[model samples]
Target: MFSLLPLGYVGVMTADAGWDTIEKLVFRPRVGELLFNTVALVVVTVPICVVLGIGGAWLVERTRLRAHKVWAVLLAAPLAIPAFVNSYAWVSAIPSLGGLFGGVLISVLSYFPLVYIPVAAVLSRMDPALEQSGSALGLGPWRVFFRVVLPQLRLAAAGGALLVSLHLLAEYGAFAMIAFDTFTTAIYDQFRSTFNGAAANMLASVLVLLCLLLLLGESKARGNARYARVGAGAQANPSRLALGGFQAPAQLGLAALSVLALGVPLFHVGRWLVAGGAEIWTRDALATSLLQTLGYGLAGALVTTILAFPLAFLVIRHPGPVSKLLEGANYISSSMPGIVVALALVTITIHYVPGVYQTAVVLVAAYALLFMPRALVNLRAGLAQAPRELDEAAQALGKPPLVAFFKVTLRLTAPAAAGGAALVFLGIVNELTATLLLAPNGTRTLATEFWTLSSEIDYTGAAPYALLMILLSAPMTYLLFAQSKKVAGQ
Candidate 1:
């Protein structure tokens, strides 16, 4: 427990000192508007995500959609583009498409994959024979879909929706571009301009409650059976429905959406690259920002991975209230917006210790706090598969607890652990809000650099940094997909 002392001291002391600001900011009308905006984004985005996800999954996995395998890859391609990158592209492409609608479009495009991937996995694994039997028993096609397919999709849909909601909650860049003020943006403004830590913590508390509600709603939707049978192998047969007349329109719709969502953004980036040429790299700020981003990314990824191990073990092995609380605590940081968390930490840091202000360590710690859940969920899945008997066997072989864990359990869980670490790394690299606030005065990350350049209407000049960020992230995306494939044994 004392191992956690340093962290507590830093967080607690700063938080206490920041109370006055937190109290005043908590009741601001802007905070209310920000809260509303946050809720609205999630509310609007969730349905679109579900519809696209469920529809795409059903079309590719269960129907005779034209070029099924091709469609599958295309649909999942959106996951490669970072949310903020997509926002930057869309906002730059059509200045008219700004604010709430613009935010919605960017978010839906970037995150629908979150819904599509999991729901599609569920659909792929479902026993389609049941649907066939329903049809054989005189149940109409509509009846079969509503009664048979929908129920099976509930848990997956819930999980995916939860992820989408959380992403929306924490979103910064996209919403920021569109002029949609949410708790995250507001918190960032407060910290950067006002340096009010207390106000930030109070807002963070509210955001945390909102996230808890979302989590509960997700759990209630998932229920016991769906959560329990997440990765179980059940015999299933591919049931493909012929598109016939619908094929042409379906193909066109999918293609058009893909182009609008993905193609346009890449085109915008290219245009910037062509226009700016050498001006983008001439700035010293770009180099500083890139270095900052790399440092934060490395530290956040390592720390999150380390912290995730014991938490994953507890959830996977213990599976009780205590474990649930631990897991839930991890979830809070992710679900609440990054600015809110940063502000909370800022308050804690300023009031308590005041020693670590604007340090690289605080910024990295904020990243870990925000993205640790990714590691937790991924590692927990892999850990659950490791049988209890293996531990006993390792012990019987004269291995100590730590040695047995490393030689046996850790080795077996390596792929999942690595996948989780990659996710944390990717998230940290792309992270903006906490990086913006807690980052040292001279430090600038790729995200901050992109923002700074863009803010000054130097869109062309920002292109290189934006493109670099994407390039760095692309490999991470590939790793995520590759790991998923391995997990799926595909």
Candidate 2:
């Protein structure tokens, strides 16, 4: 319900502005241009990401690829570098980087992990029996793969595509750094000028419509297809396809991709660090930003994980229509762009709870809304592994339900919960749009500080924060990778 507050805010703003004003605001040429750029970015970037993501996953999981582990790690490593940071690296290297081409390149590098991670997991656990049956029926490998294998990937691919679309739509810093005028950047610009006036509100409404359309499209495409295996014995490891003479080309392609996606950003950040000199690492400023970022990440992760616990429990323990509806609502709310979530929180607190306006509490609330899905995913995975029989057995032993939950179920789930928190921490450390708008006075996170220095073209000064963010995110990314494998039943 809290997640829907942003929708309410948009609705109220639209009603206040009325139909004529909305028609005027939404129908302008500049608005049309922004929409084109934004939609074109999604249209061009997602399929490429999907192809690259699925291809990378297939190479690592289903082929006799050399250094599969190394390739897997390298492919997923781009997630550690935020999109805006990726854009900064590209622009630093090629000063003329801007527009749709530039936006697609940087975004693809940063977000393909969204598709790659899940698709890789799906590829990893697929039962060999299905493919074997297809082969026995006189099907060629490509036919079996397309007919038998790829269909199972529909859910994961669609979900990944939806995430990528949302990221592209909500993105501000990455696009803004390159002067790509999406609705998000335009709304931010309007807010700078008018401070949440009709123009910004109207742009946000259009963006909300785009988000809903993507959600609905994904749902429709996903439609009630059953992929679960029945009459299953123990699942067998999928057979690896022989690359034969094509091996060299496959290896070369992945190597080139790594160079473009992961190598460029790391090399430029290192170059800046070298140029910055030892003195550019201001001890006081760096430490404060580092500590504050840590504090915010920890606090927000804790709150989000706690909130996700009961919801995760409900959905896992009781899989009914009510649970599904509640879970869906949570997901739909979390799908809202961070900028809209932040904007809503800012407006809500100022008008309804003025004392808490710009407070750390509100900032944390924004993080909770924006990131609750991450925590929920991990918690649900954890809870699924823990059977309710154990809880009932504890109750049979005379312990109260709450105590049994804390001592037994909670202990069993702690690692996964911690894993979820770590993912949330990684997100908070790199988050820019919401933190930029919602952070309280005198607050400076690593992301915000990095953006500030980089905005002034102090590339050298920004290097440390980027390095720190990547370093901090590395372990969490590994955790996520490991978790994917585990959950995929590999």
Candidate 3:
């Protein structure tokens, strides 16, 4: 983690002489605009995600949509395509799709499923007793939906929206290609071009502030629990609103949106694959990159998930200001972009522990730093669902705390833990910016390989790996959706 400290030390000592140049980066108009761009992207994207989430959940769970299971799988499959790769696909397909709208489109396509999966799970598990009670009282279907069902959706929506917002704020590679100016892009620009350490730090500090404000907003929206064991055994016949007049338009619109967002990019990849199969299918180098990427991603996910358990257990079992702070600190690293975290770690390592600089271990640690929050968030939610009474009952027996935890609590939380691990693994596999900065010399993950090829105007060469990554990420997404269903069930 301290892999970049010595570089920071050098930057600090040098800044003593060029303080004026560094001062130029301290929250200027450019920074403000970048900040606004980032916030606007989140603002635009989160609503889209939420709407898609709620609507998709309704369509699949309640409405008479055919092959709803297939739709569920399709919606979640987009998550398999990394944001940057999605950017590459879209930009290559339609050069005009660049800037704010492009960012929103890619993010919505990539992240709405985060919202959709959870809300759909919640919808699937929702008990219709209160809703029926509302109807029994003299309320219309819309009234029941707006007043009752919508209220129940707030927690799941908040959680999903929070994830979207954080991802937007911290996004890097996708933004780099899309001509969207955000703090993350600026920070990376500073690091790559001038190596302007102070400028990057200043931007990072602002990004962190933005994240805090977002956290506060999410906290407010994430209300206290209402009912715990809902839809466990109750008949969940959700009231499906009829779309008699609106059916064709609704289906057409959804189909068009999905095609435009997902289809065009895939079409471009197909073009490349058909045109340059022989050129891109060279065995040795591609295999090496794929293996390295898989190893690093799998290793990083395992380590991060293991590390997150203690923090999550503490926070859920012993909720307090201190515990919350520890959990928040864990997310802070994640809420910031990979480049920023990589820069900070680079500075720390370069100055304090030079030996670890640019090593694979340092790179894996960076992945853990950037992705542990994901593990913690899911695990904490899972832990909260574990009945406290079970622990008490276990203690009543002769089982030790550790033994009881492993035997009971951990067993109960395994699905959630596995779910979180799946998310982390997916993230590490798709991650780009930090991997580029921290990976050992000559070491190329699929992300780095794709970026390197794309940088050289070799998009054709990049397609195979991009396709492979999407394929690898597909099953992980399915597992996540399944786990979400499991969690919502509980």
* Best candidate (score: TM-score): 2
Residue lDDT tens for model 1, 130-209: 68878999998779888888888887788889989988887877777777787766656656665764565455566666
**In terms of TM-score, how similar is model 3 to the real structure?**
0.88
Clashes in candidate 3: how many? Answer: 17
Q: Which stretches of candidate 2 lie over 4 Å from their true place?
A: 231-235
Error of 2 at 227 (Å): 1.4
- 43 Cα displacement, candidate 3 (Å): 2.7
Write down the RMSD of all candidates, one decimal each.
3.7, 1.3, 3.8
What does candidate 3's lDDT look like per residue over 115-195, in tens digits?
Answer: 888888988888877777899999987798798888888888898998889888878888888788898888888888767
Q: lDDT (CA) for every model shown?
A: 0.77, 0.90, 0.80
The Cα RMSD of model 3 versus the native structure comes to 3.8
Residue 272's lDDT within candidate 2 is: 99
lDDT per residue as tens, model 2, 286-356: 99999999999999999999999999999999899988887887787777888888888878988899999
- Say which prediction, candidate 1 or candidate 2, comes out ahead on TM-score: 2
TM-score of each: 0.88, 0.98, 0.88
Worst 10 residues of 3 by lDDT: 1-10
